[model samples]
Target: MKKLACTLIFILLSCHLFAQDETHPFTIRGLIYDEKTNERLEGAVVSSGDNASAMSDKTGFFQLRLDRKAEKLKVKLVGYEEKNLVIDFDDESEVKLIIRLTPEPILLQGVTVTGEHFTEEPVVNSYSIHPGDLSKVPQFIEADAFRAFQALPGVTTAADMSSQISVRGGNYDETLVFLDGIPVYNPYHLVGVFSMFNSDILQNERLYMSNYPVSYGGALSSVLELNSKQGNNERIKGSAALGLASAKIALDGPLWGGNFLISGRRTYFDFLTRMIMGIRFPYYFYDLYSKYVYPLSKNNLLTVSAFYSRDALGLDDDKVFVAQKEIPNWGNLFLNFSDEYFLKEKSSVELKAFMSRASLGVNTQVFFTDYYHQMGTTDTTTVNNYIEDFTARLTFNSHPDGQALAVGLEAKREAIHYDWNIDETDLNGMYIHPLESLFFDFAPSQYSYSGDEFYLNAFVTDKVTISPVSELTAGLRGSYIKNLKTFLLLPSFSFSYNFLPNLQVHLSYGRYFQNTYSLKERKTEAVFTPFMATFFPEDKENIPYSDHYASGLVLSDIFSEKTSLEVEGYFKDRNNLA
Candidate 1:
């Protein structure tokens, strides 16, 4: 029996060895550089996808293997950025890269690539934001990815805090952000003045306003997908930049004896907050990000990613009627790893695991007519809101013959905690606080507790070309909320009719939902009422909100496919918010 067991173990070990790698004819080579400074970046981490990795010496150069029928090769590092390459591994290949970094960006995930989808490309209600579009926007000199969405048809930015974005008139929390395959909640800061994400580290930002794939949900209005550069297999690279709030740096290259790449970034805003705010208050924040990828084999790739950020705001008010100091604390963290396995020339599978968490806290103490902390009025109040989402997902992508199909299953769990005081209100409809104090940190809270929620979902979609001139896209998605024991089904489809090769009429519609937000609902949720750093619970008993969405588009080939005019209109609705 012992001999037989040893034989079986030997067989399994042999199989594992065979699955590791396949040596082929060609080798891959490349160079890496700084995207902003246009200088060679040395010590950049570069890897094919797994095991093998090499850092750029003094020259930012790299080299890796290319097995026949090979899959994806990625390169990553710290201080600059990462780059990814998808190639047919039969012959030798060479590529160059420019890594970008700006101050302290929050977190960076993988890039999502799309250009020509046979489904006639939703001509009307959609717009594509490419790496170049980021440069064309006047304010984009800062490379704030989410802000660019505001210029599109259905997008808007929170007027005061520039970072928060709303799609098709939807609420700020209705939107969703995806980094690589992981989810990011509240991807901005200080009423949205700065995007929590750094553009220099990202390769592309795709904003889905009215039309989005079923692979994502839990947000009501739209989806913003950010793609990071895959680590370079050919060489190491890096970059750095300075911004209004902070400074940052990054690097990407190979590992695993030259088969993997690692990348990272860190910001210092706490070091810069000395800047004054008209003597009313002082503000500051900071963050760090890192990613790594390994090429297990030509057909299989592995990756890991992580991020962290923290922000603080302090305000003081001293007048004839009020004396108060308001302080808010916020931050986020995320970690994820994914595997891309190819089954055939046209079919592939992706397995991923990730964890994300965020928190927003406002601690204050008010004063009374006697300048003493009031009982109910001046009582110390603390509103601490935190959200943590852990997820695991599996996806299958196939483009067989004329059929485009994708299927996936995902599970996400969330936890939220809010603690604060709702002072009395006046006739003008505002919470009237009775007192104010110094050295604010919630003035010390009395009662505190937390809440938790979870969700499980499955989705699938397909695009089939019936003929030339016309095509169809159909998809279905459903999510089950473990906390609410509720399930929501979303079905989507789009049609495009081309009267002329350069002219096509398109129509589309879909249902959407989003989780991971403050749940702050007020009477008038417009661009005017800025974030006040207080906790206001929306009347869920009166208005329950779970999801939000929009639908509609236009496509015209006024010029070549490279440059065309597109016009789109959309509408959205939501229920239950605070």
Candidate 2:
């Protein structure tokens, strides 16, 4: 009986010691904004004590968790004044705040600073572009997103007039583009002269050339992610611009305790060409965008976004006397709905659904006449192509201690349809010259093809800090293709070391895969047609994949705070060309 009493007393003492060792951390959530303009600020750094730090997201939201013993917080960002706050919180407590930072004027040797500015972070092989800086570059009488990307290192274009970028020796179709966490197919307009994205509506743009996070997949070369701005929460505002090539308008305001934005742009190139050069170019393009944001609560939000773009080109019998006419048109439509809920100050869950459709059509007619026989023949052709995609994705993010963990799952369904009809008469003796005879084809054919593909992807990524000056990121992605009946696994890793306050080095390696293929005729000039095809693994021996290796050194504030330089070298090995 005495021994049993002693055992019970020791058990009670052990339980008390375990409770004393457990620590309940405090969480703080906040939004950072510009003090005078009330605009949300992204990329701001928020640090609590010494071990906890977070950067503001595209929405200007930031979250930090700290131990009970922490007492101070600091916020810093480029072009803004640094601010410090006193923290007073108990165990298991939560706090919310709104911080406003004032802008600071930059002076370089007594000269007012103007032009492009750059800032460097710790992410490896990653770059970001601001919308304000895009307007400074000259491109087709308007700022272009893709054109701006082409100016970056490791990115090259096929031709001077083409905006299709090939990154690190990868093909044009190897790059993946995303807008608001949704994939975008056929993102070009004006025969690859410009991108469909409107510069005025963009909030954030990021490019990952190598070792990108596992949250994104299904691409072999690179990733370009773009986010649209949330409308003004305080007041209503509108802007309109009229340029030589296009006209655009934007409206944004608060609605029903939320925010809304609408923007549209249209080009009048055909009309301008007819008036100035007496040439009926017969080509025009337009795009429309809308976004709605509803803040359900302090930590929950809902977003709905829609986009539409159209391009039409026609050449009737007005300009050519040979009785020839061709009309080609293409367009894209996208819709997305997303919901975000915060489970804790440093953890969140997001659910998103999106649909995208792309279409192409072509109609052509040609006629031939024989003077000796006084006879005429006609050739007509029609082609129609359509592609549609439906996708759903769920992502979860958590920050425990100083490390970050993210996991996501995505499902996609894609459908494609292509049909063409061609009817031509024998015109071998109708044309006088051999060159003219080549235009009068003698062929009659019809073909139709359809396909459906389903994809499932899951990924997990972790960011760990091994020391104060070094950080590492490890990720893995798994994907399954139903049509191909194949499974793929991709792995990514990156390491960054800050050797000095203003100098850093980074290394990264990753494996990537792609299931879609873009087919075009091997010609000297660019061709805009409906010739894209999908790969079926059952019929193919190998799937498309690429391995990337890159290393870079970044120098920040070499001469001044506004001056920064990045030099990177990369090697890529691609197999099973798409």
* TM-scores for every predicted model: 0.66, 0.85
List the candidate 1 regions with Cα displacement exceeding 4 Å: 1-124, 257-281, 314-327, 361-383, 421-449, 514-555, 559-563, 569-578
lDDT score for candidate 1 against the true structure: 0.56
Which candidate number has the best lDDT?
2
What's the count of clashing pairs in each model shown?
97, 0
Candidate 2 lDDT at 84 equals 95
Residue 446 lDDT in model 1? 36
lDDT, residue 128, model 2:
75
* Residue pairs in clash, model 2: none
Candidate 1: tens digits of C-alpha lDDT, residues 1-578: 23433543453344334333445334455556555443344446555554444454323444444444346666665433456767563443433344333222224235322332212345334455534447556574365777766756556665634667777767666677888767776666554577777666565567777667778776667777787655555456677777655576777665664323233333444443435433433466666777776657755667777888767755433411333454566778899888877553235578999998777666565443334534233434455666678889887765443456677778777666545554442211222122111111222223344666666777777787777877788887777766555676778777777777766667777776555444333333332222222222232233234332333334444443433455544555565543
- For residue 41, give model 1's deviation from the true position in Å: 20
